[model samples]
Structure formats: C-alpha cells, structure tokens
Target: MITKPQFKSNDYKNGLYLVATPIGNLKDISFRSLEVLAKSDYILCEDTRVSKNLLEKYQIKSKLISNHKFNEKKNTLQIIEYLKSGKLISLISDAGTPSISDPGLVLVNECIRNNLNIFSIPGPSAVTTAVAASGFSDKFLFYGFLPEKKNQIEDEIKKLSNFNHCLVFFSSSKKLNKLIPAFKKFFTGRKIVFCRELSKLYEEYIRKNIDELELFNNELKGELTIVISEKKEEKASQKLSESDINLIKRMINKLTTKEITDLICTNKNIPKKVVYNFCLKLKNEI
Candidate 1:
C-alpha cells in the first residue's frame, strides 16, 4: 500500500537559512525551499544576477544581497547584525547547497558565533546526484574539486587512489579533460561516470572503464560531476617462495631497496609495498 506524506505548515524562523538551490533545472527546487525563500527578509546570493533568474521564475521578491567568496567575510558583520535583529535571511549559492564548494561558510560561522539560529533547507546536490546515478558502491567520499597545480593534482590523485570506495569530484570541462591522463594512470581498473549539465536539457552521463577513457576532441560545455567506481577485489598475491627469499638474499647486498623492489615487481603479481617491506625486513636483520 502506498501512503501519501502529510504536509505540515512551516513555522518560518528568524535566522540564516542555508538553502540548497537547483544545480541546473530551476524546476528541481522543493516547495519548502520556495516557501522559505518567499518569506525570507533577505536572500544572500553567490551571484545576484545568476540567482535572480531562479528567484524571478518562482516569483520570489525578497531583496538580494551579494555574498560570494570575495565579499563573504566583509558581509559577515552586517549579516550577523541582521540575524540578531530577528531577520529571516536566507543564504544560497548560484547553484547547489551553499558551502559545498560554494560561499556561505563565513556567514554561517558568524551566525554560530553570535549564537544565532541557523537552518538548512536541503534540495539538489550534484555530488549525491552523480554518485546515485553511478551504480557504484554507496560508500563514497566527496572530494569537492581537484587542485589546479599539476604536482598537487598528481599527489592528490595518487593519495585518493588508495581508497576502496566510490569517489566523487567536481571539475570544469577543460580541467577534467586535462586530468584524463592522471585519472587513467592512478585509477586504473575502475569504472568512471562523467555527469555533465545535470538535470538540464543537455544532461549527459558518460560511463567508461578508466583504461578506456579518452579525451574529447570537442570541448564539452558546463561543469562536470565525476564519480569513480569503488576498487575491484583481486586475488591475494602469494607469499615469497623459498627460492624468492634466497634470490633477494643474494641481491640484498648488491642493489638498493628501490632497485630491488623495481626489479622484483617487474614480473610478479605481488604489490610493491609487499616486496619493499620484505626487502626492509632483510636489511634490518643484517
């Protein structure tokens, strides 16, 4: 039997409301989010111009205040003052939930410092949206955006490669294309999903094995939410044989640890860590 939800009247409170807006399609907004925005004394927007389109669509007339990354800290005092004065101010990003790779944290922290009331009016989120559609393990980690520097990005990806659960990331099309090589190198054997223009008319989900992924010849438009599938289980590598230990004992005095590791791992299915640790155990025994 299907049961309908019993809707209740919202008792709008006076405080800062961290509202989640639609990631793409403006129609994806919730009734509760709309009601809160409609009754808000003011709306704090990451970009008033971008937010205006959504607000106007729903006929919400609340005064808009610019509250992006550059000006959030400066606007903190005044916003806190408004909250203290019992004003119902709502903070929203241009899209998605505020503070999820978006502005709103500064003002939220200010509200907390002043012991002011704060509420979250949840709605659309690109992270969960992409992960849910990925068909990967539900256990996941959301790494908001990758770093810009090549070395930093490489280091980050290398570290993230160790996790066994699904991983999500946000990136512009250009950045994502540039990252294809790095993704291929570190995330080998994993499945990947590229979610572009989510919920919009041109929405797309490009799924591929990491090894099979290739850079697009033509540039793709809009932001991308990427989901990498969880690591696949592999058969445990066999323990070193008596001959293997004797071979390492012979080379232990002649080759460096790294050289030994590289040489031994060249043809073996064993992990470098296992070989490296074994090499170290032989060294310490000397």
Candidate 2:
C-alpha cells in the first residue's frame, strides 16, 4: 500500500466523467483516469467498498457515492441534477470500464438526455483484453453477460444462432455451468476460448471447440470472458480430430441415444444434459 499521492488536482469540465479503473492489477489504471478522479467533485462507483481500495491507493480524497445495479435508476435523477448544477462527477466501476457490464449507463444516459458534457477516460476493458488474446481477431460481437434465467439464456442464444462474428460473453463462475452448455447447444462447430481471471495473477485461458467440449470441467473459478469463433480456421489442426468424429459416427449406429450421450459426457467432461442435447442433434442429422 504505497500511499504517496500519485495525482494532482486538475480542472475538469462540469459534467459526468467516466473513468476506467484497472480490471485486476491496480497498476493497470491510467494517469488520465487518476487525474479525472482526483479533480471530480465527487465519485460515483459501483461499489463504494471496492472503489475505496482504489481511492485509498492514490490518496484520491474525493467523496464517494454508491451507484450500482440496485440504486442506479433511482440515483440517476440526482446525478443529472448534480451535473446540471455544474459539478464534475466521476463514474467508475468495481473494475474495468464503466457501463461495459456494470453500472454507469443509467447515469450516462441521464446526463446525455440533459445535454451534459460526458467525458470518457478510457483504460482497462476486459472485452478488448480478451478479444486481443483471442486468436479470431476479426469482426467481433460483445454480448455482455448472459441473463440469469434459463429461458432468457436459451432465447438469447437462439437469436444469435446465425451470427457469424466472434461472439463474446462475460459470465460469472457460478452461471458458467449452464452458460457453457448453452454455447455447446447453439454454437456447435465453433471454437471457444475461456479467458478466466484475465490480467490477474491466476489468469487462465482454456480453448476448445463446441464439439470437443469434453474434459473442461465447470470446476473453474473466477470471472470469465467466453469467446466463440464463427468458422473453424485452419490455423491449427482440429484437436478433436476427424478420426474422433468418424468414431462417434460409427458409434451412432451401435449405441442408443442415451448410451451415446452418457459415453460422450463421461469421456469429454461436459455436463450430461448438454451431451444429451448434442446427441439428439447428432441423431437427428443422421
């Protein structure tokens, strides 16, 4: 906890200043972000407790307010009034860019509706960080985090079924057990990469295809950025291999749907329900 003041007070415009904080490593924060945060009249953050650590780090003496999921809508009106009164308000999330998958959108929109000046001091973004690491650096689509309900998740995946771009999703470790299965069902034949705990010391990247979805257990922990590539590129040989597919095809004739589903799930480490669905799809095709 090196607490020497790293920033000096500077004059920022009277509006909402969106400051990007570090995703994991505190040092990943930018100088401009520090300057904006230091100069603001007050700081609105997703979690005052989380932002407290950041503020304490730089000795950022600005006042802190809680503006997260629950209170954002209610607080937006007050924030709008604050901006109208010509005060520089800084908005930051627990980590990464504000409004990407966190609170700040409501406040930003409220500020916009009132024609208040909005400044974005961009820095760390898990979306771009994961995309940059993902090999499919072509056209990309960030779908934020998946909805919690099962039906909503299914509906969202169905809507994006024909999407050809690299689909990106921010999923929590808990929801991933269901979310990964959704990806398996909808994005078959696509290459998937799990960027876990990105930029953190325990950072991990697990890449696999929708078909070869075995062996990667849902026992994974930490924040996840799941990227599914559109088309199978020839850059690397298919790890699952054509021979594996041929064997599965051969088994399709001998094994019952349930038996085949059980075998694949056991072999691949995928969830039973997902493997069952995959087998049903495979059975329908042949």
Candidate 3:
C-alpha cells in the first residue's frame, strides 16, 4: 500500500496563490495544495458551497470569498487591495485549475497591474489530462471553451484555419449535436478525441474521424474536452513569413537580438525561436 505523503509548513509568502483543485476525484488533491489551502489567509472560490466539499474533506478551514463570473468584476478592486496589503490570497475554481476557462482572470490581471506576486500551486487540469489520454500530437492550441452559437464557433474555426496544430477546446453536452457536425463541415478528414467527464467514474472517450463523428447519437454527459489532430499535409511552419522577415529586417539595426526577439515574439505572429534565429543571422552579418 502507498503511504499518504506528509507536508512540512512552507514559509507562506504574501502573494496571490492560484491553486488547482481536482476536477472529479477529491483524492487527487496534492499535499502541497492542501498546505496552501490550510495556510492561505483568504481563499477566493468560484463557488463556496462546491469548494467547501473539497476543503472539508481535507479539513482545511481557510476563509472563503465568493469570486464567480457574476461578481468577479465587482470584487477585483477589493482583491487587489488585499494583495497590496501583503495578505496571503488564494484563488481556486470549483474544480480543476482556475483561470484556464474559469473566473480568476480578472483578479490575476488586477494583481499583475499592481505588481503583486502570483504563484501557481499547479495541480490538475482538464486540458492536460485529456491531451495525455488521447495519444495525439503534443503541439496544441487550447481554445478553452468555445462560444456556444454555431456561427461564432465557425468564425473561430475560420480564424484558426491557417495553423495546423492539434486543437483543444471544451463544450457542453448539448452542443455535441452542433459541434460534431460543425467540425465535420469545417475540419473534415481530421481525427478527433472527445473525452467526456475525465477523471471520473463515467469518463468516456470517443475518438473517431471528424467525418464519422456525426454518427455518435448516444447521450453524452459531463464536460467535454475535444482534441482535433492536425492534417498531415499542413506541416508546422519553420521559416518565418514574409511579413515577419520584413519586421526583423526593419528592427535589425535598431535593437539587440534578445530585444528584437522579445518585441517580435510579443507583437508579431512569428514564433520566438524563429525570430531568435533570424536575429542571430542578422547579428553575424552586423
């Protein structure tokens, strides 16, 4: 039998802690996560009632503050003030990691603006869990949860049409009827893995050709994580685009290679390594 791990009291810092709670199983919560919860001064939860179930299981009694979608904007100022005052604040979603598809983005942004330290406890995530289970290409663009409507979903797919990467996104069970067919029409011939209720008792995976996905007529439950493999013909780009080349040429004489790399990577659509190599080639000539 595997003995339960014990945790030492970490010198809790005065910063924002982003804790990742379990998506389904409570037992998956790590020793560090429990320690953070036990030690944090204020815990911002997406749902107090739901989070209480997890906290109670571990005997953690940290002060819980409501921070869901409905009230996040209203609470941002107060949360930032708490951080500024050197209070130990923890942000947690009801399940899984916070701020991926959850409501911690506002608080995080505010904390960033005020120059407060933010630490990630780094535990469970639906994106990584599903991707690991699917045996698909590791290179993926996780779009979090896509818009509900058909038109918006199509528009989003159209925007990402140029990039040939394994695509990851979340959707509700109701949208499976629309989502499967939309993906078929927009991204045909690709293989997709629809993981339903990951890390739970009823977890199911439906890996089928995108063209054949419409035939899945069974009622699906829990949240869905969809991963669409890249088309074989559309290889990942190695060379920079003409526009990126022009940008690099324009900035070559004006900035350091590292500075140019940072600017291009931050503002342009080019990859960092690609831009860095371009800078190196320019640096050699200089």
Top model by lDDT, which number? Answer: 1
TM-score order of candidates, top first: 1, 3, 2
Writing each residue's lDDT as its tens digit, candidate 3 over 1-286 gives: 4343355656778899999999888889988888888888899998899999988887787899999999999999988888888888899998889998999988888888888999999998889988888888888899987788889978888776556888999887877777766787778878899998788888888889877666457768767898888866734467787887898899899888888888876745556788888889887987
Model 1 per-residue lDDT tens digits across residues 22-106: 9999879988898888888999998889999998887788999998889888999888888888899999998899988999877
Using TM-score as the measure, the top candidate is: 1
Which candidate would rank higher by TM-score, 1 or 3?
1
Q: What is the TM-score (0 to 1) of candidate 3?
A: 0.77
Q: Which stretches of candidate 3 lie over 4 Å from their true place?
A: 1-10, 234-286
**Candidates' lDDT values, in order?**
0.89, 0.81, 0.84
lDDT for 218 in candidate 1 is 88
> Any runs in candidate 1 off by more than 4 Å, and if so which?
1-10, 237-286
Q: Could you tell which candidate, 1 or 2, scores higher by lDDT?
A: 1
Where does model 2 exceed 4 Å of error? 1-11, 215-218, 232-286
| TM-scores of all predicted structures | 0.81, 0.76, 0.77
The lowest-lDDT stretch of 10 consecutive residues in candidate 3 is 1-10
lDDT of 2 at 85: 90
